[model samples]
Target: MTAILITGGARGIGRATAILAGARGWSVAINYVGNEAAAQETLEAVRAAGGQALALRGDVSVELDVLALFDAVQAAFGGLDGVVVNAGIVAPSMPLAEMELDRLRRMFEVNVLGAYLCARQAARVLSRDRGGRGGSIVLVSSAAARLGSPFEFVDYAGSKAALDTLAIGLSKELAGGGVRVNAVRPGLIETELHASGGEPRRAQRLGAGTPMRRPGRPEEVAEAIVWLLSEAASYTTGAILDVAGGR
Candidate 1:
């Protein structure tokens, strides 16, 4: 069976992708830093969708945690066929100058360094040169990577921009090995992340501003990620798909 790992699978895009991928017959490993309740619910949803699911608690930013998480998934599933680098966080809304050092460090630690570590591990196990069948790696970036997020989250935006670069570079480095690396940039999606950003109503406030007249749903972004994780996108790689409804 095809086995895949999804970081930050407790809620939002990660949760949606886990459920969708499960329904598609992929065994799933969900990595969450906290929120065991949400993660448990997501685990059940994956099972309900008809796939074996494992929920592992770990901070993706820490090397030991990332290693343990992947190790646990490898032990449970035997091998990995795909991975979703979706684990990330944002601080309360503020200007760059007003943001604290801890906030910036934590932001890059998880959003940038954490993603880098996860991708590196995925490449190690999924590369054909490493004696394993190749697989796909999908990084969940944000539209902020392009728009810069201005006064709200320049640090977060910068981290995601780094993710885009990593995806593009890794795609070329791994294409010959049969592994696909791509990214999905979600716009104003209706997810709980807004609350953490100190603007729970942000999506609602910005919905009409987008051409679609509505903020996107997590499921919409998941659809793009699911496609990238599937054989249907066999010829596609290094693509940064925007799930942003023309925002």
Candidate 2:
């Protein structure tokens, strides 16, 4: 059976991906820092989709937690076929000059360092050189990487931009090892991330500026992620797909 693990799987695009992977008959492992209730609900939904799922609690920013998350998945499902590094956080909009060190540290810790740690584990589990079967690694980035949300969180944008480079460099490094690395940059998507940024209706208000004239649904992003995980994208790697609908 195909087994996949997703960080921040309790909500937003991560939740949608977990549920959809379940529907596709993949054993899903969900990692959530807090909100056990939401994680349980997501686990139940995955089961409803006819797939086995385990909701594990851990903060990806912490090395011990990251280790525990991957350990739990390996023990439960034997090994992983794919991993989605999606656990991240957003602070209220603030210019780089106004942002405090703590905010930047937290953002880079969870978004950049956390992703690096998860990718490292995925590499170990999915590398042919390591005596394991190879698999896919998908990094959930943001359009803000390029757009650079001025007057908002430029730090977040900078961090995701770093992730884009990680995808490209890591993909090239692992291609011969049977592991494919790629990323999806979602635009103004309708996710709770906006509210966390202190703008709950930001997607609705700003989506009209895009050519699509609306924000994307979490499911839309999930589709791209799952496809990347599937064999259909066998020839694709190091790709940073933009799902922003032409912003």
Candidate 3:
């Protein structure tokens, strides 16, 4: 059986991905930071769909935690067939000049270093199948990376832009190794990501800015992620699938 690992799987997009992947017959290992209840809920939801799933707790920014999470998955499922590096954080909105240095550091810790650590470790375990074999790595990014969100939060946008480069570079480096690295850049997903912008009204403003005139559901982004991680994207790599709904 193909096994997959999804970080931040307690709720929102991560939970959606875990459930969908389970429905598609993949063994799922969900890694959440501190929400046992939500993680267990996801585990139950996936299992109820006639799929197998396990929940593990870990802070993705810590190397040891990430290593242990993968170790557990390796022990439970043998080896991972795919991974989604989706765990991250967004600090309260502030311009570079006004943003607190410590706040920016915290965001970078989770958004940039966390992804780097996860991908680095996952790459070590998942390599090319010389005889036509390999797995997939899907990184969750944001459309704000391109738009810059100057008036709102540039720090978060900058961090995601760094992730974009990480996906692109790793894609090239891992191509020969048979592992495909790609990213999903969502526009304005209804996920609580916007609440961190220091304004509960930010999500509404974003929705108004989008052509779709509504925020995207977590399930919508999960659909794109499941596709990229599946055999359907056999020939795809180093690509960013935009789930922004006409941003």
Candidate 4:
């Protein structure tokens, strides 16, 4: 059976992806930094849907945690077919000058470093049996990387921009190995990141600014991620599927 690992799978887009992947017959490993209860809830949802699922706790920013999480998934599933690098952190929203250096660094630690670490691990585990058979890596980026929410969260945007380049470069590097690397850039999703920034209504404002006039749902983003990992997108790699609703 195909196995998939999704980081930050306890809530929001990550959680939705885990559920969707499970429904599609992929044995899943849901990794969460904290909030074991929520992770368990997600685990139950996957189980209820008749998919084999496991919940693991780890901080994606830390190398040890990333390694352990992958090892655990490997142990449970025998091998990995794809990975969704959806774990990310957004520091308090503020202007560039006013944002604390530590906060900015933390965002990079998770958003940038974490993604590279996961990609490196996936590279090691995936195989190259033929010209078109290999694992897939999907990084969760933000449209803010291009839109540049200057006054609100420049640090977050910069981190996501780095991820975009990471996806492109790795896509080229791994193409010969038969592995596919790509990204999904979500525009304005109603997720916990906004709540942590002290503005639950931020999604509303962002939706207003978007041409769609409504924020995208977490499931919408999750569906895009699952599609990129599926066989239907076999010829797709180094591609960034923008789920921005034309933002």
Clash counts for all predictions: 0, 0, 1, 0
169 Cα displacement, candidate 2 (Å): 0.5
| C-alpha local distance difference test of each model | 0.94, 0.94, 0.88, 0.88
Q: What does candidate 4's lDDT look like per residue over 153-234, in tens digits?
A: 8889999998899889999988888789999999889998898877887888879877888989999999999999888889
For each candidate, give its TM-score against the true structure: 0.99, 0.99, 0.95, 0.96
Q: What is the C-alpha local distance difference test score of candidate 4?
A: 0.88
- Please identify model 1 stretches exceeding 4 Å from their true place: none
**Please, what are the lDDT tens digits per residue for candidate 3 over residues 1-247?**
7799999988889999999998987899999988899999999999987678999999988999999998999899978889999998887776788988788888899999999999998788888643323699999999989999885778889989988998899999888888999999988777766776667666567788788888788999999999999989988999988899798
- Candidate 2 per-residue lDDT over residues 1-247, each given as its tens digit: 8999999999999999999999999999999988999999999999999899999998888999988888889999998889999998899998899989999999999999999999998998888988768999999999999999999899899889988999999999899989999999999999999999999999999998899899999999999999999999999999999999898
Every model's Cα RMSD, please?
Answer: 0.7, 0.7, 1.9, 1.9
**In model 3, which runs have C-alpha deviations exceeding 4 angstroms?**
129-133
Off by over 4 Å in 4: 129-133
- Against the true structure, candidate 3 has what lDDT? 0.88
Lowest summed lDDT window (length 10), candidate 1: 124-133
Tens digit of lDDT per residue, candidate 1, span 1-247?
Answer: 8899999999999999999999988899999987999999999999999989999999988999988988899989998899999999988888899988998999999999999999999998889989768989999999999999988999999999999999999999999998999999999998999999999989989988999999999999999999999999999999999999898
Native-to-model Cα distance after best TM-score fit, residue 108 in candidate 1, in Å: 0.4
